[model samples]
Target: MKQLVILAGGKGTRLKDRLGDLPKPMIPIAGKPLLQHQIELAGAHGFGEVLLFVHHRADLIQEHFGQGSRFALPIRYITEKEPLGTAGAVLAGFDQLADRFVVMYGDTMMNVDLTRLWSAHEQSGADATLFLHPNNHPLDSDLVETNAEGWVTTFHNRPHAAGQFFRNLVNAGLYVIEKCALEPWSHDRKLMDFGKDLFPALLNRNAKLFGYNSPEFIKDIGTPDRYDWVCAQYEAGIVQRSSLATPQRVVFLDRDGTLVKEVSAQGLHRIEDLELLPGVSAAVHELNQTGLRAVMITNQPVVAKGFCTEEELQQIHNKLETLLGREHAFLDRIYYCPHHPEKGFPGERPELKIECKCRKPEPGMVLEAQRDLNIDLANSWFIGDTTTDVQTARNAGVKSILVRTGHGGADRKHDVAPDFVFESLPEAVQFIAARSTETSGE
Candidate 1:
């Protein structure tokens, strides 16, 4: 069994009102100590042993768990005489740690699949893997900028009030680290933090730092209000849903008019004709950071009309991904309908000329995606520039947003009312992200 380390030494002054002399890990949640929940989650995920780095109120933690026998896993403690920052405390117990071990903050209330995370780390062969997620409060959280491959390109801690807007993928205070990654700075005397100090150093050296972006519930109960919110989530079983097992919130997007500049009028058949609209890359990048699945749902009748072959259509999509990759934006998957109901063209394929359920204004694509992606329809949204897109969303039982960019605004004269209207993808993303915060009460 791999070893696990819990950094429980912080003073947790922000939570002093509820903690008193006890540490934040000792704070009771749903009739059990918070630390107990973490330990049990670890044990279930194949971490059979735990090492707790304690400083403030170490005796309370030790007395409560007592070698972890009652918890069904052996637990050990390492008391830090001085305040060693995040990385320093872990390095202090260097000898006991395995070549690869898991480290998580004691204050987090997250139920991640440790086995899956560890497997990802082992398969990637990276120096370290940080558990990253899209949080509602990216304004004050440490943000991570990654490429399409999920490799950390840059790490930024809490930026200044006037800093430029960034992606919402923040560090979730959980990681898998190799002992070799920290050996270089083990002898340093100064404070060593993971986000502010160690991670930046690793980036500067161009070390491989991968990020595992998960949608599992993970939050820091630093303040009193946040503590209440976490407890409520636990009671509602929100924290219990693992990313692999739970339904996801997705943003269904139309391809031509919504995501890129529509070229059907000019008959776009070549890869050179496919160009991403302004701010489209950043918009999709923000969606990626928010952990929302961006699935391209489009109606491509060009294939049925013989304007382009299926292979050519794929090349067009490949070009879209390649262009977005330059901006560090990526889409999870793409689904297109190659059939057209009416076909009077000279070279039209009769078989594909029939009306299909997967076409827009029908719900087949959304329904198929729902089955394949485990999408939560109520929490999902559809962004497009046509009445057909809005009708598709309505038929699929999800909210809809009509953009004014492509065929939206005056061009669309339909009785179907969208939930909201925005100028473009960027404006639509802002509305969705802000609405998520309001509903989450973050």
Candidate 2:
């Protein structure tokens, strides 16, 4: 079991009304302090020691969990003379840290399965593994980009450029880091943050950084609005159900002609050509409120035909994500198969022209999603615009919906019939939402 370090020094400027005499982490949630919940969660996951980095009103925090006996873990505290930034505080206490440790923020409310995150870090041999996820308000958030192998490629800090495109992956304020990775910067530390400063600086040195993408619920209660929202969600049992220990209900979606317009048969290879059909964003936003995971599973064979490069394909999907995000909607994950079984195009890449299992109508993509997301396929559903997607659902043993938008079963590539038919994605999503409500007896 590794040690856990919590940055419990937030002053709660925006939450002043809620924190009159108490520190931010000492604020009560369900009759107990928020920091206690975090420690209990860490202990449940086998963390034997806790290192609390405190500054604001350190007395209250010290008096509450002195020695961590009641919690069955040893609690250690390091009070800072001056406020250091998130990473600076950790670097300031460098000698007290373990060889490897987990970092968390005091303000954010999370129920992450830390064991799963730890296993990923140990297997990759990377200097650090960041917890990345897509959030609705990504324009103002710090973002990270990753390659297909889930390796961090670059960091996009806050105050993002006006029109530059970026993936919707946000740094969800949780991380796993190696002490040796910080040794290089231990002596020259000033005010620094993990996402904005330290992480980017390490990337320049060619240190391997991994991005662990997850869809679990983790929100920062920084503002009064956000604080109240999290309290309500916690009362509704949403927080408890979001842990990765439980299986999630997913609504798997097809990309072309389902969410984005089917601009051409070759697929919308160019970024400018990608556009959302009517009511797509709002429908997805509504599904988001239902707590069901929205995962994009699409077959993109344009790369095999050399009609578009993988870089161009990423931009097109970024456009899709940006459009949905503008309306307060986002997907949990986007999985695409770049292989095409058929060959002989004018500029086709012969390597990508081989038969593969990930192509749709095969269950490879869906099964892979099930394993990564812990999806309950028996209660899951898939919606698309072709009989090929219908056959994919049948092959994966999940309910299917066909929308009469692009191809609309007119391709007739397969003689499979969808379990349900609709004129558009909105209608199909409405049916699923209503069915879920009926099943849950809500």
The most accurate candidate by lDDT is 2
Candidate 2, residues 80-106, lDDT tens digits: the string is 778879999999999999999999999
After superposing candidate 2 on the true structure, give the runs of residues whose Cα lies further than 4 Å from its correct spot. Answer: 438-442
Residue by residue across 1-442, what tens digits does model 1's lDDT show?
Answer: 6889999887779989899999889999999988888999888887878999999999999999999988789999999989879988887788878788899899988877788889889999989999887655555668887776789988767753452444457789899998888888867756789888899899888888999876667888889989998988777555764354578778999987788887766356777788889999899888765556788899888888888888788768756765665576767657889899886897888889987899988999999888655789999999999998998999999999999888884545456889999999999998897787576554
Deviation from native of the Cα of residue 312 in model 1, angstroms: 25
After TM-score superposition, what is the CA distance of residue 325 in candidate 1 from its true location, in Å? 23
- Cα TM-score per model: 0.66, 0.96
- In candidate 2, list every pair of residues with a backbone clash: none
Candidate 2: C-alpha RMSD to true structure equals 1.5
- What are the per-model C-alpha RMSD values against the true structure? 8.9, 1.5
